[model samples]
Target chain A: MENRKIPDNKIKIPIIPVFDPIEELNMYTSLGSLHTFIKGSKIISPGIPFYSIIYLISGQLEASIVSRTGEEKYLFEICKNCIGVAINPNDDHEFQITAVKDCIVYFFTLDMMVEILSQDANLLKKFILNIVQKVHYFEHQARDLYQCRSSSRVFSFLYDLCLTKGKRVNDHYELAVENISQKMIAKITGTHPVTVCKLFTYLSREGIIKKNKKVIKIYDLNKLCNLIADEELTY
Target chain B: MENRKIPDNKIKIPIIPVFDPIEELNMYTSLGSLHTFIKGSKIISPGIPFYSIIYLISGQLEASIVSRTGEEKYLFEICKNCIGVAINPNDDHEFQITAVKDCIVYFFTLDMMVEILSQDANLLKKFILNIVQKVHYFEHQARDLYQCRSSSRVFSFLYDLCLTKGKRVNDHYELAVENISQKMIAKITGTHPVTVCKLFTYLSREGIIKKNKKVIKIYDLNKLCNLIADEELTY
Candidate 1:
C-alpha cells in the first residue's frame, strides 16, 4: 500500500550477484546466450528437455505448474535481475514459465554454470545462498497460504508485492510492474477468482484500496497492515 | 509404511558431494572439526551467533523452531551424510537443532565453505545444486502442509520420511534412524498431538500400521498410498 510510510528494509528483495567481474565477463562472453520474448510469450514449456539458469535481464516472468487435471497453479514472479535455476536434470519440466511482458533473459546451461563456478568461487557461494533464501521465503509463503485465511492471504500478497516491486510516488506506492490482473492475483494468493473479486470489492467499499482495471491503488496502507497484523494473531 | 514393494528409484535421496579430493583433504586438515552430541543434547541453540555447515556423520538430529507462543514445531530430521548449511549470518538462530541420538557431526564454517568452493569448482556447483534441490523439496513440503488435510499431511510426512531415510528390510521398510516420537510427528505434520494419536489409532485398528513405542511399522503400505491418492484429489 502506497499512502503510508513503509520502512524499506521490511521487504525482502532477492538479489542475483555478479561475484567476480572478470570471470563473469568471460563467462557471459563464452557461455551466455541472450533470448528475447514478446509479452505473454511462453518462455518455458512443460516436458521440454533442458536444465539451466534463466537470468532475467528485463521485464517480468510468471512461473506456474499445470496439474494432471489441467488446473494451473501460479508459483511466483521472476522480476528483472533475478535468477531462476533448474537443478534436477530428471525433472519433467513440470514448471511452465511465461513472459509477463516483453523480456530479455540470459540462459546458462548447468554445465556452463559449473564452468563458471569453477572460475568464480564467490559466485558459486552466492548462488547457493540465493536458493537458500528463496527456500526460506517460499516456506513463509506456504505457511501463510495454508495457515492464514483468504483475506489475510490477499493482504499478505499485496504487502509482499509492494515490498518487492513497488515504487514510491509522492505519498503513495505504485507497483513497478504492470498488467497484474485479478486472475493473476487469485492464482498467487491461492484463492478463487470470485473470492478475489469479492475481497477487492470489500476493500474498495471500506476505502482501503481502489481498483482501476488491472491497477490496484491502496489508499489506507496502515489499514491493510493492521488487517494483516490482526490476521496473524488469529491464525 | 514399508511392507509393500517400493521401487528403489522412486525415492529421492539428496546427495551432498565431497567436491575436491585434494582440497577436501586439505579442508579437513585445515579447518574441519568433529563434534559429538549425546542424545537429547542441543546441537544448535536459539540466539547463537555463528553460521556453519553441519554434516551428519552418525546418528540423528532433529531441528525445531519455537513459536511466539512457545510451542516447539519440528521442522525436519537430519540423518547421515546430509549437510545442513546456515547461510544467514545475521539469523537469530531461531532454529534449534537437538540430537535425537548420540551423534557425530562435522562442522565447517561459511568461510571454510567459501574456501572449499574456491579450490573445487565441481563442489561449488554441487553445493549450489544441493540448496536448489532443497528449495524444491521444501516447496513441495510447503504445498503439502498448506494444501492437504491433517491425515494427508501425516501420511505424506511418513511417505517422505520413508523415501529419504528408509532402508529395506526383509518384508517391511524400516527407517535408518530411530527415536521418532508422536509429539514430533504431530509437530512435523502441523496437527494436534491428539489428532496424530487418533490417526495412529485408526491406522492401527484398520491393520494398516503397527506402532511400537516410537517406531511405526506399516503392514499395508498400499492402503496408506491409496489414502494419499484419495486425499490429493479432494485437497
Candidate 2:
C-alpha cells in the first residue's frame, strides 16, 4: 500500500485493516454515510439534535456529556469489531474538544441502522452483540474499579486489555492502547495521576512491561496473567 | 387503575403511565410479550446459547457471571423506571441461576430489539440514552467506590440515587430503595455484610432512616446530601 497523502486538516491515524472479518457493505446500504474526522475535530455539537452510531476504523474520539450540574467526559476510544449506537435525538449533552490523532469513522444514522437491522436478523444480532460486548467491558471495568485496590487495579486494567486485544507470540503478548493518554487512564482508573504514575513505575521496574513513552510492550504473558489473578497486591 | 384479578402468569408488570420529564412509550413499546418469573427463577441458564435482554419492572434479580476461574454475582433489583439490560451473549460468560423475586421482565431477542429500533429512530435513541444513563449511574458508583473511604461511599450512593429518582415534596425528598435486600446492597457497596448491618443500625439509631424489612426509607434529604458531599465519613 502506498503512503496516502494526508488531508491538510488531519493527521493520519493508524488504522488496522482486517481481510477476513470485513463487514458486508451491502448491509446498511441506505441509512448511513462514511464520515472522516480530522484530529481535534467535532462530529456533533452539544445541544444539537442528531442520532447515529459511529464505527471507528482508526482514530480516537471523546464525548463530553453536559448536564445541569456540570460536564462529564466519556471516551469512546478505539475498539475493533465494535460500533457505537447513539439513539437520542433531542437529548443534548456537553461535548468538549480533545483529539489525540486524526481518525476515520463510519456513521450509521438511526433510521438506516434500524432499517438494516430489521431487514437482516444476522446483522441486527451482530449489532446488539457488539453493544452487549461493550457493555460487558464497561461493567467489568466498573467492577475492577470497585473491587480492587489501586495497585491491583492497574494490573487488572492491563490484564483485561491483553485478554481482549493481546496477540500471543513467542511467550509474550503485545498490547495496544492507541491514542490513550495517562490522564485519561487516571480518570478511568479513578485514581490520582501520581497513583497511576507510581503503579506504572512499579510495574516497569518489575520488568513485566516495557514502557516506551506511550506504547507498552508486555514481556511476560504468564506473569501478567498471574498478577491479575493475585489480589494480594504483590506490588 | 382497578386491581383486576389477572392470573399469576397473565399479570403484566405495571407500566408507569408516565416516566418523569420524558413521557413516551418508545422505551417500553417493544415489549410484545411479558415474562413473569417467580422469586429465585433463572432467566438465562449458564452456557446456554440464548440472546435476550430482560427488562425488569419489579422484584429482585441476581445474575451470576461465570468464568473459567470462578463466578461473580450481580444483583439487579428493579423499582419503577429501573430496567435491566442483560448483555451476556457477547462472550462465553454465561449467567447462572442465582435468585429472583416475583420479577416481571419483558424479554426480547436481539433481532427483535434491533428490529424495533430500526423502525423508530426516536426509540433507538431513547434506548441508547437509557443505557447511557445507566452507565453513568454505574460510573458514579465506581467513582464513589474509588474516592470515598467507607460510610461516605454509602452516603454518596444514597445521595445520588435521591437526586436522580427521589420525589421531592415540600423540603424533604422521599428516597426509596425498593424491593432490595440489605445483603444485595452490601454487594453493590462492596462491603462486608456485618459492616452494612452496623452502618444501618447506626443510621437507624440516629433517626436518619426509618427502616422496614427489605426497605430503607430515607427521612432527611439535606442531611443525606450533606453527608454525601462532606469530605469526612459520616458513620
Candidate 3:
C-alpha cells in the first residue's frame, strides 16, 4: 500500500487526532474544572444543562441516547483521552453519559475552549480532526449494524472490543468489560438479550471464549476473526 | 423549550456551523484551487490519491463507498456549503463522489487549511462543529435504516427531503430531485428498486405526492409525515 503513488496535488489529513492524557490535563487544567465520579454514577443526564466538552482523563464510561418514548439506544463506550460533545445547549439533551468505573473527567466550558482555540490554530485543527474521526467511526459502526445479522453483530462487537481494549496474556487476550450487563451488550449489538445469552453459551461450548465474572477471555483471536469473516461472507 | 433556564456555568455552542458559499469561495481562492465538473463526472474515486478537503460551492453530488468486491453503498448526497473529508491519507479510499449536477467545488490542501486555521480559532471551531453535525446526521439516518421497514425508510427519506430542500409552491412543497432515479432512491432507503417504484406509484395514486418527470410535488406534507409516524408505531 505504501508503494502506491498518490497525486502530488492531493493532500491528506489525519483521520483522528492523537492526544496524550497527561499533556491534555496540563493544558486544560487552568481553564476547566476537574470532577470525579464513582462507578455507576451519572456524569451527564437528559434535561440537564450541559455545555462543556467532557474529556475522559481516566477510567471508562458509557454514553447513550434516549428517545422521547424512553427507548434507550447505547451509543458507545468512552475510554481514556476521548472527547464527548453535546451538539446543542438549548435543546433537551437526548443523550446521557455515565461512569462505568471511578473516573476522572475535565469539564472545559465551550466558551473557554473557544476562547483558547481562537489563538491556537493547530489545537483547533486537532480538535476538528478528533470530531471528524468520531464521525467516521460512528458511520462505520452504523453500516455494520445495518448490514450484519444478529450473530454477526455480536461477533463483530466482540472482535472490535478485543482489538481496541484487549490485553494479551500468553496466547490469549482478555478484556475486562466491567459492569456492562448482557442487556447493555444486547443494546449495543442491536440483538436481544436472549440471543446474546445463546451466542455466549455456544461460544463457551466451543471453547472459543470464557467469561469469568466481568472479564472475557478469548483463547484464539484468529478463530474469532475467522468467525466474523465467515459471517460476513454468508450474509 | 425556551422557558427553561440553563445553569450559569453551562455555556452554549452552535449545533451546526453556518457557512456562506461566497465567503467560503473567497477564503479558499488564494489558498486552494477551484474546480468544476460536468454532470456525471467523478470527483473522487477508489484507489485514487484523494487527500484534500472538498467543499461544494454550488450544485449537488452523491458520495458512495465501494467494497473490495465491488459492492457499492450510497453514503450521502452533498449539497451546497457542505464539506467532504477523506479520512485517511495512506489507505485506499473506500468512497467516491460523483457530480449529480454540474458543480463548482473548491479543493483546499490539508497543509494550506492547517496553516490558515492555525491563525484563526473561531473558524476552527466552526469547522469542528460542522463535522460533528455531519456525524449526528449520519447517526440519525443509520438509526432510521436499522429500526424502520423498507417502506417506512422510503417515506422518512422523502419527508426529510421535503423538510430540508422542499420549495413552497401554493399550498404544496416541491422537491427537484432531478437525475435521482428510483434505483438511487432504493439505495438511499435500503429498499429494493421494485419496492421504490411500487411506493411511488402508490403515493401518486393516493394524492400524497404528484410525480411529473424527475420532480416530486408533495400535496399533503402532513399526510407524509403522518405515514412515517404510523410506520414507527406499527414497528
How much is the lDDT of residue A177 in candidate 2?
65
Error of 1 at A65 (Å): 4.2
lDDT top scorer: 3
List the per-model TM-score of the A chain.
0.71, 0.64, 0.70
Candidate 3, CAPRI quality class derived from DockQ: acceptable
TM-score evaluated only on chain B, model 1 = 0.68
Predicted model with the maximum DockQ? 3
Candidate achieving the largest TM-score: 3
Give residue B183's lDDT in candidate 2 (0 to 100): 71
- Per-residue lDDT for A1-235 in model 1, tens only? 5543122112232322111112233346347888899999987776664467888778888776655334566667777677777443444546678997999888887667777766665566556656666665554555555456788777767876776666666676666334567776776667778887887787788888766864667767888777764644321
lDDT of 2 by residue, B14-79 (tens): 111111221233265456457778877677665554456555556655654454345464523444
List TM-score per model, in order: 0.72, 0.65, 0.75
- In order, candidate lDDTs are 0.63, 0.55, 0.69
Model 2 chain B weakest lDDT span, ten residues long: B8-17
Residue pairs clashing in model 2 are A31-A112, A64-A94, A66-A94, A87-B125, A88-B125, A114-B118, B39-B100, B39-B101, B40-B100
So what's the TM-score on candidate 2?
0.65
